[model samples]
Target: METFLGVDYATLWFLVIGGLFTGYAILDGFDLGAGAWHLFLNTEKDRRIALNAIGPVWDGNEVWLVIAGGALFAGFPVVYATVFSAMYVPFMLFLTSLIFRAISIEFRSKEPMRWWRQSWDVAYSLSSVLLALLLGIVLGNVLQGMPIGENFEYVGNWLEFLNPYAFMVGVCTLGLFMMHGAIYLIMKTEGRLFLHLSALVQKAIIFFIVSFVITSVYTLIYFPHLSDRFKESPALFAVPLAAFLSIANIPRLITKKKYGLSFVFSSITVSMLLIMVAIELYPAIIMSTFDAAYTITVHNGSASEKTLGIMLLMAAIGAPLVAFYTGFVYKTFRGKVQMDENSY
Candidate 1:
């Protein structure tokens, strides 16, 4: 057994970051996906149902983002600084979108005007789209490698990060989340809205699968470095393979009216994608476009053993508490969502 202090710092950091990502994907994923159903819901009643489907859970779901960022800052300061500084603009945009999303949800109930409600809905949905795309672009940049100088700082300009590969990844991420939200809507609501969400989910899944394949091939070809990793460790493919299988089962699960199962599979797909990226970037918390040796490793990026030990202890306690609270909220809000005429 590895002692907490003796464990590879890089591995531990990876585990922390990975856990946060997985939790976020499973929790925020449905809420984001629920936003996708916003477009399909025509009636005011149906829209309210869509909103309430995620209302109880969306705010709580965002806690994972905080956890993920906190883990990065504490466990992998180098990575946190490098990625955030290099991707500052996009990160800001992403953050702004999240802010709008929160504000929209909060103020949505304060007004009964049609325009006010509609504006909030647009803000919520648009924010979802931007957040999804930003996440994808960040992943794409990581997989493709960043331009880090001798001092381990990002040397590339903002525009340099906006390549075709990154753009495709953004699209893929957006489509996947939309599909995820659709599945959640199907599971959480009933009536015409539920059926409409189901159909939308199916379509979104089809788009996601097709785009994912194309982007995968493009990523492999353009980023031969990533392909080399796969060649050295063929097991890495298992992540995507698992994702593919889960995605394939989504429709079947939905057809049987297994909404929870369908959402589970969709969440699995996102989790597998995160695992795949983490695997591809192993040992290098921040890769350098100039030279692999310039890349930041776990050992180099980590805090002191004392700091990590303290973090581990806190995580052991806090992580479970967060999980318990999250689970409690979800359980408390389970079952079909109904929206009254005056509902927020």
Candidate 2:
């Protein structure tokens, strides 16, 4: 119950964990997005350029994910234990996709055979799309509720994670990442390639808008509880409003050939949407579908206050170092990708 600036340590840890994952989602989301475009880009040179575009920084971007996962495990061991144990299949699929994604990037250019490159191309694109989908499904499932019982055990069937709502959320996540990736690709190409990617950016814009709108409508109609908080407290509505504006700005920026600015908004859109999710499910890490009494609140799911405090102190010292290095890598490799013999 220790307070930091009037917020309890638990709540602060929740914010820290959320912020770290948000950073992961934004950084890795583009990598996945760029991979999603691999097959659609036409020609091996285009794909290689796309690969090298992210090459210098893609693996480094994953460090945020590792840190985020570790932070969650440290700050909320109960939530971490239950989620990883119960949602075994989805997490495994996620891990598999992550590995395949890395493999596709590394192995795609190792040979001169068309079949070999095409094989890795398919692996890269499919894995990226699947990874995005799995992330969405897990989040959707979490947003809906868990089937935890007394003693904080997962009592329901693991296959229940495949419900309709989760699939819809998964699709939305894919579309959003695709759009985000298209915008990044624009920044990494020129001339004909840029025009081709411009067309893709347009298509991705429409795709995400349609997916986002459809998912929003479905949630509003069938998932009332998720929106109840914003409805009751009108101020919380700004999050969604900002999300709308961010999504809207991407197209305008693209039209103006301002892809750098567009990518910034793409990052913001992901952040705002996740922040809204955090707002909708505050205090409660996982709501129990079977009984409200069985729900896992931050207090129930977290570690000892001392453990959280120590981990938080570590994050405070460590986050900036990670961010600084990440920014440095990206800055060093910024601008259009110039592929050479050493390129991916």
Candidate 3:
């Protein structure tokens, strides 16, 4: 129970792990979103523009996922073991989508045949959509709570994950990513494609807003505990307030033709939403459906103090390097995408 300025090592590591996953969601989210939009573009050039828009950064963006997974394993091995064991089916599907996403990007242009390109397009779009939905579904189930029995093992069958709330959350997540991806694409294209994306951006905003409102209403009705923190401490209300404003800013920015700002707002929207989730679940990383005593909190789920301290030191070095690298990549690739011989 080593304390850093009154906060225990476990809490500190919880913040670190949360930061990593939030980074993953914001970074890789748009790329996945972009991939999900592949089939919507009309022409070969438009499709290529969509593909190459994310080309320079998709792989690098995905590095965040790897880091997040490793950080989860390192910081909360028990949580990882329990959750992953329960989520093997969805996890496998997620992995499969990721593989197809990568291959779709790589193999799309390797041949000139119409059927080959079309097949890969379907693979790419479907996988990207599936990946986003699956991520959401997993998050939804995790939030709803797990049935842990005997030595912290998940006792429920996989079908239990297909509950209505989880599926609604999945749809909401897909809508959010689609909106996010469309905004990113707007920042990287112009003329006819921009017009196409411009039209799509407005629609995406509506789609996301509708999904978010429904989900929020559902949570308020069925999951009242999530809002307890904000109700108990009015100051913590700023997280949701900030999230609401960020979400509101997107459509406004888009109307003003400020796509870069719109994209920034989209990223902020994602980060703020996740922050709200962290606030809601603070301490309890996973809640037990069967009984309150079985809840897994930051205090109960962290690694050894020595292990955490050493890992924190390593993370101190590594996290900034990753941030700097991510920033440099975005900076170098700034502005609208233009295809070249090396483009995806």
Candidate 4:
């Protein structure tokens, strides 16, 4: 068992994979959130402005998702295999939504016809909403435990993935992304559209807060195991505390007309919530409903130490470059979106 900074390679790889997905969630989250708001912009020009707000960065943001997937496959093949196998329908639907989203964004502005634009707008918004829900449902199922029987194999039916708890998480995820998207929109638009989004963002904030409260109550009541870690170590409660404070600060920032700071807090809220999930499920990647002994954990599910070490070295070299590139793109595109001929 190789160790880096007193942590095993498996644990390190787990953290790496988690970090990659967290990046994806934060970066692409607003894109999905913005798309989720597509149908609500009220006019063609409003829609176009919203669309172009994310134009330069959406595809680049998706790069994080791609990297995260690759990291998952490399670092935890068993969990990857089992999860993909178990949630085949959801993942396929997710991929379909992703395709529709991309095509909707590209195709919406390709024509001037009212019918054509309207059709694509619906597709874009629906796909974005579905994508957010599916991501949450998948995560909810993972948190609740899967029906892994043996050999780290998932023996559950696809329909089982849509249980009540998962749906609540899905709704919660959608609300969070919508709020995040609204804040981003407020930051990027001005005049009538900015005012519209400013009002809409308040509703989004309320939506997310309500959904979060319901989901938290459900998890604490039905999935008590999630809170076990916090109970065992009282200080670990700070993650959720931070999550609460961050969520609280977003509305505060928005009210103060500090949308740029609001966006920062929104990103922090996403990161903190994911961190709490990581804390709740440390060591175990996927819990087994059939039997606790059959759970897939970092130690049992990870690639060989040598493989993880090599990949860790690769991530170390590549991560900084990716971060730099992402920063460069955001920096280049920073400030209010102005529409021109090149705008989407």
RMSD of each: 2.0, 0.9, 0.9, 0.6
Cα lDDT, model 3, residue 131: 94
Give a tens-digit lDDT track for model 4, residues 1-344. 89999999999898888899999999889999999999888988999999999999999999999999999999899989999999999999999999999999999888989999999999999999999999999999999999999798888776999899999999999999999999999989999999999899999999999999999999999999998999999999899999999999998999999999999999999999999999999879899999999999999998999999999999999999999999999999999999899987
lDDT of 2 at 103: 90
Candidate 4: worst 10 consecutive residues by lDDT?
149-158
Per-residue lDDT of model 2, residues 200-314, tens digit only: 8898889889988998899889879999889899999899999999988888988888889999999999999999999989879999888899888899999898988888788
Query: Top lDDT: which candidate number?
Result: 4
TM-score of each: 0.95, 0.98, 0.98, 0.99
| Stretches of model 1 off by over 4 angstroms after superposition | 1-6, 340-342
Any runs in candidate 3 off by more than 4 Å, and if so which? none
| Residue 283, model 2, lDDT | 78
Distance (Å) between predicted and true CA of 195, model 4?
Answer: 0.5
Clashing pairs in 4: none
Write candidate 1's Cα lDDT for 1-344 as tens digits. Answer: 23456666558867887888889977887677677557567877887788888888888899998988989998888888988999999999988999998898789778789899898888888888888888889888887889988767888888787988988998898888888888878777777777777778778878888889899889777777766677897877777779779878988987888888888888888888888777777777677888777798877878787788778888889999999999999899898886666457
Two-way lDDT contest, 1 vs 2, winner:
2
What tens-digit string does per-residue lDDT give for candidate 3 at 1-344? Answer: 69888988888898998898888888888988888888999788899989988888899988989988998899998899989998899999999999999999999999989899999999999999999999999999877788987667888998788888888899888888999999999889989899998998788889889999999899899999888888889999999999999998899999999888898999999999999988888878888887778878887777899999999899999999999999999899898888788875
For TM-score, candidate 1 versus 2, the one ahead is: 2
Query: 76, model 4: CA deviation in Å?
Result: 0.5
Cα-based lDDT for every prediction: 0.82, 0.90, 0.89, 0.94
Candidate number with the higher TM-score (2 or 4)? 4
